[model samples]
Target: MKVTHNTAAGTFTLTGKMWSNTYPLDQLDAWLAFYRRQRDEHPKSGNSYDKGIAGLGRCRHSSRPRPADQLALRAEGQAGACVRVLGRWAEAVSRGKG
Candidate 1:
């Protein structure tokens, strides 16, 4: 997957499988904050936290995974990529590089 952050647009984009999706950075920031809180509250449930993040991404993007749906799987993977991208962006922002 290819991830890009556009500071001018305040957007994060993930591209793969000949498709791309863009999300508002502010929304992703909110999601990260909530995810961190959930992680802190339930530190032992790593899988649960991942599911929650994926679910939120799917919901926000109107992507519903279906059985035998490779495209859906690809989209889900892109969502995960988006999470990683946003994490890196957050770090950059904190370090004043964003």
Candidate 2:
């Protein structure tokens, strides 16, 4: 996956294997800030997204977030889901599951 920021548009473009998505920078930043707060407040939990913070969960039409869930991209809460996807991808790589 690749992520690029467009300062002019104030958005982030996330390009994955066969799909791409654009999200408002403000929304993404807001969700990251929330994730940081959650991590700091619960250090023992180690920044787990499984609790569904900021509406992290399966998409309405599927059991999990996917490129096909374009509807979720319109929701502010789903901004965090993008971060969560990146987080999970990192974790999988670290564990040699990617």
Candidate 3:
């Protein structure tokens, strides 16, 4: 991904691809959408979006932050079905069943 900062003085550029496995394809797509909207809207003094998104830098969400069933995760937490993996064959490896 590319990041650029422009102000009265000049411009600065930052570049990096995702540095973590937590960034799955679907999650990356959704986050790119959020950033695109932020760029389009240009909200919050032209810097808040950067700060807010940067705060999430190198940090993994417990789950996808957008378009995922937050309620499902919370409810599953209470119901003892709190599985984080989403693949059809993903499961605990304790019994060699992952």
Which candidate tops TM-score?
A: 2
In candidate 1, what are the lDDT values of residues 43-95, reduced to their tens digit? 78756566546655654453322222433344345665545445555666677
- Name the top lDDT candidate: 1
- Give the alpha carbon lDDT tens digit for every residue of 17-68 in model 2: 7998777755665644565577778889864643434332122122222342
What does candidate 3's lDDT look like per residue over 1-98, in tens digits? 44433211122333556432233333443664686578668755566456436533332232222222543444344433333333212332344544
Task: Please give the lDDT score for candidate 1.
Answer: 0.56
* Candidate with better TM-score, 1 vs 2: 2
**Poorest 10 consecutive residues of model 1 by lDDT?**
62-71
| RMSD of each candidate relative to the true structure | 14.2, 14.4, 15.2
For model 3, the stretches where C-alpha displacement exceeds 4 angstroms are 1-28, 40-44, 55-61, 64-77, 83-98
Q: Give per-model TM-scores.
A: 0.30, 0.31, 0.27
Q: Enumerate residue pairs that collide in model 2.
A: none
Tell me the lDDT of candidate 2.
0.49
* Cα lDDT, model 2, residue 57: 18
Residue pairs clashing in model 3 are none
Error of 3 at 80 (Å): 3.5
